[model samples]
Target chain A: MQERSEPEAARGPRRGRGRRPTAEVRADVLDAAGALLLERGMGGFTIEAVAERAGVSKTTIYKWWPSKGALALDGYFHAVESVLAFPDSDDVEADLTAQLRAFVRILTGTPAGRVIAELIGQAQTDPELSAALLERYSDPRRELAVRRMRRAQTEGQLRPDVDPEVLVDQLWGACYHRLLMPSLPLVEEFATSLVANLLRGVRA
Target chain B: MQERSEPEAARGPRRGRGRRPTAEVRADVLDAAGALLLERGMGGFTIEAVAERAGVSKTTIYKWWPSKGALALDGYFHAVESVLAFPDSDDVEADLTAQLRAFVRILTGTPAGRVIAELIGQAQTDPELSAALLERYSDPRRELAVRRMRRAQTEGQLRPDVDPEVLVDQLWGACYHRLLMPSLPLVEEFATSLVANLLRGVRA
Candidate 1:
């Protein structure tokens, strides 16, 4: 891990570098990294590559991220931060079905899907990265899913005995498998079918 | 891709001044590579490394596998070929649930899990490798799952309207997400809960 205590050299001081790049600059760096990741894939991606692509200084990147995994996580966090929003309709089944279908489409129809698969793969290799990814990305989505499932159960649309957290895990897991494995196509029709099948057993 | 007409070292004679390596010797090389992959990660693994580990010439490896991806695929195929066996029992729900739990445990509990995750990541970068992975490894399990789900539907355990392929995808996807994402605690209890939830929705 790169030690953070050292006063890193300022990168490309704009007018002698105006006050370390702001959050917007950091966001741009992450966006650049994400785009580079989709283009070059993770194998060829590096901090220098991201810095060059973002047109930011390596020191600026280092100031923001301690390691490549950290940088990737930053990008992942931004990409997936708002993806798991649960529906608000009183009809729990419709709400679950809609959210799940949207989730499936987002994963199968975008570059972020591939990026996420690669990140998950890296997590398998690096335990620290795995921990960070779960905490920064997976946990919040899971909690939101769980909360929605619980709300649905309370509305009498789902079995009260069903564990909301576990159901959410299973739903997400199924989505991951479909996206990464791709042995089964993840069309909207398939998503609707899956949500229906799952609800058949759990819906009260 | 390298032309398939002849081995890269077709001109090279058998290394033996007194003993030439045979076809069996080629299998031995792949076997050694598999062992090395199980022991060492891809970064530290190389054709030269495999040759050294196998006590064979690098020429033999190149003759068999044009790239490291091909070699890694061989290893992965060897490991997963026997890992996913669908139950043949008549009690569809019981058998499916048992198999589901077993699949979850095997995928997340072993080094193969990490290896599979890395391969998935690699696949994102290599389309040919991804196709090969799905064709040889991913599809067989899917085929078996589809077969089982279809059987259940015929037996009236599953609703006639449920699409077998879609249901299998959902189940497999969910388990896969848990394994690769490391978002959910992979435990038998969680698997059981998922099984129950899906069963409620799918059972006729």
Candidate 2:
């Protein structure tokens, strides 16, 4: 495993004092941050702008997230977490299809996808930023799918011989291919066919 | 297709006079640019620095390429093109294995890979940069693989029913997945296995 830095969740609220900030404030800040990211691109985005747009103080924002990248990361995750809920079902085929389809929807269909693309771009040069993205955005999410596949393997829905990680890669690789290279359109049918073809090899 | 501003190749040799600069001068500039990219990274990279390093004027550099991005792109292709060559043989399996293994070697084993990663990140934020990357880096290269697959199909080595584009995506997507996320080591065995398994589905 590539060495991962401790995630932001490990370093929680700096200001854990009087009247803990409400969930509404969190939502408002994230909403504003997401909007600023899309409108200004990564270059024009700033903590102060998020503060102004969200109607929250910079101190409040800093209390939650250490830096602008961290704050934007929070907003990015907010956009992602809402869309990519974990899937658990006995019917492996149905479950995998739904999960992949939902993934494609958020990645291709939403403004959130653009934020992700920008973050991915930024992460390329910045090791700390890349580590943070992997820890927060990729790991927990990938783990959920890993567990689901393991359970399916245990139940004999998938080939025991096939490595779960490779299976995951097979399912996700094409979707990301479309996302990174936008020449080809990413319709729902792509996911359906990708899953169907990969399942032929992995299914018990 | 996103409208492409003319490429550097199209705008070559503006300083065409009595003593035209030798090909060695072109090679020197690209080498310097590639070195600067490795040493200082994308943020610190600039055309002026490349000009100073290459011992050429900014006007000289601009005479060949329209922008810094274009110059860096030339250097990047220089780094990559030297490494990746097309595979053509009567034996389809041997041919693909060689092609993919060489690809993985370049992507996993060189500074060009880092350049590619940085470019991918930059491409996410800049549409023009993204288009340049797609046009210059990805499309031409991917088309080679697609053509190879289509030829294999015509030769009755691959299944006629399978879409050549999907086949290309299946092969390249996994490589990109490894590049974008580096948890798993991309050994030669991975390429060999990926091609073997993918070919199983597509083989006649």
Candidate 3:
């Protein structure tokens, strides 16, 4: 968490002598933002705090991200990017099973679940945050999964008539439902079951 | 909406002389609460307003409902009860399709969608509300659908190994995802397609 920004903090006041790459600065800010959000939750997340921790200017952050919600979403995505990455395999079931398992692990084990839950909750009333969530997080993630499913369809692993968008919904949406409703525990087994049931069909 | 409460309001100060039936009084309060929620949302929904509108005592309302959120959920359910009822036709697919279509109509056509969204959003921060939503609303609704699916399984209409609970999530959860995220439109066709896709399976 602090590892990325620590070096930037140590190099304080030497801005003019050597400017960091845009990607590096962006990574540092997002890392700091994600760490702050995970540690303190949304109430403690502020642009000022992120700027200070990342050792970057507030103006720079605003220049890159439109709003706090946007920044928070980007940071959250950045933090979880590696873990939630969609995998492609010859067997669509294997790939989906792997990805959904990883997703359930994050939702059940990590602070990322709570963070995302809060973000979705807050987005209900906040238009800007809603836009950011849809544009930056949900849409991109859905597209990635949809893309994978599309490839599977081409490979004749999935039914030609199946709507990949709805498949995405049936699988991931079930997980999201458990996350939001909480009456059911979101276990990894549920993810595997979701894939198996969808693929095999429920018709006897 | 106001039809249920208008007569009660007209009854005014005649509380002690001719006390209304408990069931009738309960109906009036819930009607008032639902109407208030739909019209003004959670922000304007209050015990006092409901009491005044329903011509019931505050004590009676509290005795029946623990909190504003609980009242709102009950009220919302009462408002949409007839429309969202689960059907038990001979064909499981037809029953599911009919129920989901009705559910989609409420979500898209009425104010219920925004009201539930607001309730869910607030529930994230309010434990009491979350409990009310689960116990009084989500859990019961889920039970109804699951029972219907379980019956289908026993009748050999559904796969024996299929998890009814997961099936419920896959269908209803997808609708909720669209409602909460709003990146996709929640249409009647989507509901029909959801039932069809789930019944037939998505395998090639």
Lowest summed lDDT window (length 10), candidate 1 chain A: A1-10
* Native-referenced Cα lDDT, model 3: 0.85
lDDT of each: 0.69, 0.70, 0.85
The most accurate candidate by TM-score is: 3
What is the C-alpha lDDT profile of model 3 across B1-204, one tens digit per residue?
Answer: 545545654655545423777888888888888778777777788999998887777998889888888999998988877777877678999999999999999887877888898888778787888889899889988998999999998999999888999998899998998898887889999998888888988889
- List the DockQ of the predictions in order: 0.34, 0.25, 0.80
Q: Tell me the spans in candidate 1 whose CA falls farther than 4 Å from its real position.
A: A1-64, A68-72, A79-84, A202-204, B1-66, B202-204
Task: Show what share of the native A-B interface contacts model 3 retains.
Answer: 0.73
* Model 2 misplaced regions, further than 4 Å: A1-17, A20-57, A201-204, B1-61, B201-204
lDDT of 2 at A159: 66
In DockQ, how does model 2 score against the reference complex?
0.25
Query: In candidate 3, which residue ranges exceed 4 Å CA deviation?
Result: A1-9, A12-18, B1-14
Docking class of 3: medium
Q: How accurate locally is residue B14 in candidate 3, as Cα lDDT from 0 to 100?
A: 47
Higher-DockQ candidate among 2 and 3? 3
**Candidate 3: which pairs clash?**
none
Candidate topping lDDT: 3
TM-score comparison, 2 vs 3, better candidate: 3
Complex DockQ, candidate 1: 0.34
lDDT of 3 at B193: 83
